[model samples]
Target chain A: MENPCIICVAITGSLPTKANNPAVPVTVAEQVESTQEAFEAGATICHAHVRNDDETPSADPEKFARLKEGLEEHCPGMVIQFSTGGRSGAGKARGGMLSLAPDMASLSVGSNNFPTRVYENPPELVDWLASEMLEYGVKPEVEAFDLSHILKAADMHKKGQIKDTPYVQFVMGVKNAMPVDREVFDFYIKTVKRLFGEDAAWCAAGIGAQQVVLNEWAISSGGHART
Target chain B: MENPCIICVAITGSLPTKANNPAVPVTVAEQVESTQEAFEAGATICHAHVRNDDETPSADPEKFARLKEGLEEHCPGMVIQFSTGGRSGAGKARGGMLSLAPDMASLSVGSNNFPTRVYENPPELVDWLASEMLEYGVKPEVEAFDLSHILKAADMHKKGQIKDTPYVQFVMGVKNAMPVDREVFDFYIKTVKRLFGEDAAWCAAGIGAQQVVLNEWAISSGGHART
Candidate 1:
């Protein structure tokens, strides 16, 4: 039984702020330090989103460059992936950091409801983000909030919008998105294997306290676990 | 196996027009006549969206009232369902005609991608639509565009948002939305039975050329078909 596991660390996502946790890293310097520490703790992938000084989200490529520089200096051999999610920025700004050409970038292939609003990854926007990822030589971890999204990723791969086998990440327990049902969890794993192939790697994520549940599901099921 | 299938006719959806089909029924008179003909042809439910004189979609309750009156007059005893869909209007306007207290209204419980953009039914909007349906004593045909919507409908039913066992409709073959997939189709049926009840009525809809396929699938599978 080959049970090698990949540990991915998402330091700062779009929603969490300093108010949510005093330890939440917002500034580029803080993010770099946080990634360095996470990498030292055996995190192979450092997934990051840059924020402004006032704790507001920012898509500035300069900040990403600085963080990338610091991570290279402090945590060599770490896979750096930028977040192209909707909350950080609107439209093309979400993908502005992709030009820095990190090892990977998160790409949501379809639209689903967030807690408060629609997480809109329109067809053109999804196509544009995939193109940018391709241009920057970055791999996309297709964020699957729903089953259709995994199918959408397959459609994109067939159209050559996504270059490699889409490394899918199942996002569950979001307020209005998919929930953490055991049947759905098992079904997601089956669908991913059916779509991408049995050998392709995948991951699962859950918001807030349910994160541990998804982590256990992914790790125990022979898939990657994201924190 | 006594499978008595319900036949629902969608006379004028938000998108189709006189350009798409010369007999699209723009005015209330046209809709009334068209419903009469469809009813005469053995359609049990008349699922309709009112249009203005120029064939533009309208959420005006006055037109809906007129259409309702005419439908009752012409197609006696036929179930009338209004479209509370986004293309007809924005925000509260989608549910404006629910006050007419038609037998049913189409309600999308979750958001998913449409042909070109996101079909945004935010949580608040979904709540509002469900509440409006409850207030008006109108049953909701839960429009399940994606897998989560069927689950969302279950949640709503448990929470008393939907008064009756939800009748879910599987919408497939939309451009960027859920495409027509057989495995997904079978899973949708299983999900509806698991969530609502084993005997809960369900329907299937396929866009354009695939409508016949969905009709055959639904009819053979003991579910309703939407035309």
Candidate 2:
């Protein structure tokens, strides 16, 4: 069979320290440039999170707009996907970018305890956000922190809120979420295939040491690899 | 809420070697002893695989009977579960011990590629196995290699072959199956809850280093954790 068609490059997501990886982009121009580099690296889709000039996570629509405009100007055909995950805000505030309506936006399927806090997308918020995405013709990339999250995404799909063939992103390696291990990786793919079918597309992002391994697995398994 | 009641201990499963861990039991008596130790270590459920005198994998009814009798003689109250997974021999021959009718027997939900081979449970075999287990009043522990496997298990449940609220086991870390990583674990749990609801009980076993971590998570999350 031909390999899966999509490749998503997550440029400048939350938690990249300048001390750890100086290459992480903090400014809109840097974000755009990084995205361009990924696009040239065989990524047809780009999943992005914007950072402020000071390198902090930002939910500012203006930042998203800047990144979106830059991508449109630099690589017109690339699919620009933005994060609705606030990384530092309430549900309504976290998904503020939904109003901006990019080609795609993230929708976490369920809630789980992160390293020090809980990241939750309440059912009410999920319902509302999903409706808005559908109304605006924006595809929701169901970001699953755990298996239940994929179920939640499936629930949304069944309720006619999310897209029929929703795109899923398996976020691995978060402490208290799922560990970054091969067993967990295999479980996640199996869970996704169980919840969604051949029509659904999946990508994986492993935290820390797992990122490359998960990326390679996704590529080989006919699933998209989101870096 | 009360802590999850189940603790599954996989004692010397089909894989793993004496070279890896000296604790892995080889003989039938050793297997029973280790199983008792695991149960005493807080595992209420024991998943077993019979090995020949030479330490090769064996699905012989006699080995299984010895295991069951040994467990009964040593640890009377502990639940004994057997692997119906025939990694060797003809599929029909794999069910030799089903006549023993232990409390539970694993029914692999679907098939996937392993490191060196492909493990497929054809539909006819699955149906026959499910019917036999049901007739014998043996609870089938639906083993899922991927998401599709879970779906197949669900189908079995709907057909009334498997019991309602079927116990599902997410077998992680097998190549060509789901990887044993945090993200995959999260996806597996979430998917189970989403598909089966909070009423469903699930367990996980991570191959290699993930084993301990999965145990901790399963215990904390109110699910069964098998080593």
Candidate 3:
């Protein structure tokens, strides 16, 4: 029998507001309800980023605690993943929720260009975040903004900074960063296999409207996708 | 017969001060004397940066003009390439030397993490530098600190931002940035060929002890090398 795919849903990202999409969940209750719906529809993982009352992104552990509790009660067995991305906060603030000990958290192992500014994940910060995850017994979803990021994850894993084989997600189609290219995508898979053994698990992500394109690519290529 | 390799000698960089090595040239006179020796030793290109009296980096075009004049008189035909890297200055000041119209200038297309901080090459700065190079008729040596940078160079070429096929340098072995790996080195070559035609020119650079390794790889794989 074919191995079942685990679908991950990003409930509320660091970006996007009611002005962009009125249905984007902002409050804690809205986030839990959204995750419950996605869980019912077969999303095995819930990737979350908390938001303040004013619709700004937040890295509040209290909100995460409430959301984690609600998800446990409403969508039992679903893996919870909090975003440790830079958009919500800076420095250690981004990882403040790690102490809550969710199933997993997004970790960017290297820096790259975002739309207008540099998404900074300095080496010290990367090591600190990985150590925090190790302490809390949480798995990390390595965010591969470019090819080097995936390779850096492998290096970190070998050095014992990461406890297990790093799970990398190839992100594409972000403006001024990596764009979607068929050949580069194939190479990314080859790199993952070469670095983390042939049977290692991996995933791919596409921003905005290109998410559909990544879904088709990931599904046909025997990897996971994020929505 | 094969295409002869063009050797580029970077006499002084933004980092690595005279304190690290007494031989590291900091003054205009010292830099000229160093380049004269390297030029005579078959170095076809001289990549340079200027410094203040106190040994700190400077973006002074006047100093650059003096260096260009000295290189012309002392090492005629040796390609003079000024560095527009962020370490020496901020914003437009980084490109102040472009008006000198040296043979080339280094331009970073994307951002990545350095050893201790973010190597910030924001989009606005990148575009402005490229445009300045275009106006001054200076060829840009696109510094590819990571894989996405090479792709960004290709995109700029397509949009007419870069006047010609970019000369990309794949840099590796920096902490929190791309590290030196054989497979990745090979992939960088393939990516360069895939983006820019098969005949397009490229290069590779490595920090500290990895320089020898990248030199060997670049030469054997039919690309330029910076020493």
Judged by DockQ cut-offs, the docking class of candidate 2 is incorrect
The 10 consecutive residues of candidate 2 chain B with the worst lDDT sum are: B109-118
Per-residue CA lDDT of model 3 for B1-227, tens digit only, reads 57889899998888788789999999999999999999899999999999998888899999999999999999989999999998899999999999989999999999988888888988888999999999999999999888889889999999999988888888989887889988888888898888888988988888999999999999999999999
Cα shift from native, residue B186, model 2 (Å):
16
Summarize candidate 2's per-residue lDDT along B1-227 as a digit string, tens digits. Answer: 36546877778888666877787898889988888887777788888888876667889999899899999988879888888885734577767788899999888744444554446565556777888888888898988766555655665677798876778888776642466656556666776776689767898877777677777877777678786
Per-candidate iRMS values, in order, are 0.8, 16.2, 1.1
DockQ-based class of model 1: medium
lDDT of 1 by residue, A1-227 (tens): 47578899998887788898999998888888888888888999988888888888888889999999999999999998889989888999999889889999999988989888999888899999999999989999999899899889989999999888989999999888888887888888888888888898999998999999999999999889999
Scored by lDDT, the top model is: 3
Give the B-chain TM-score of model 2.
0.91
Please list the residue runs of candidate 1 whose C-alpha ends up more than 4 Å from where it truly belongs after superposition. A1-3, B1-3
Q: Write the per-residue lDDT of candidate 3 for residues A1-227, one digit (tens) a residue.
A: 36789899999898899999999999999999999999999999999999999999999999999999999999999999999999999999999999999999999988889889888888889989999999999999999998889888988899998899999999999988899888888989999998999988899999988899998999899899899
> What is candidate 1's CA lDDT for residue B57?
88
Clashing pairs in 3: none
Could you list the CA RMSD of all candidates, in the order they appear? 1.3, 18.4, 1.3
Better of 1 and 3 by lDDT: 3
The whole-model lDDT of each prediction reads 0.90, 0.75, 0.92
The TM-score obtained by model 1 is 0.97
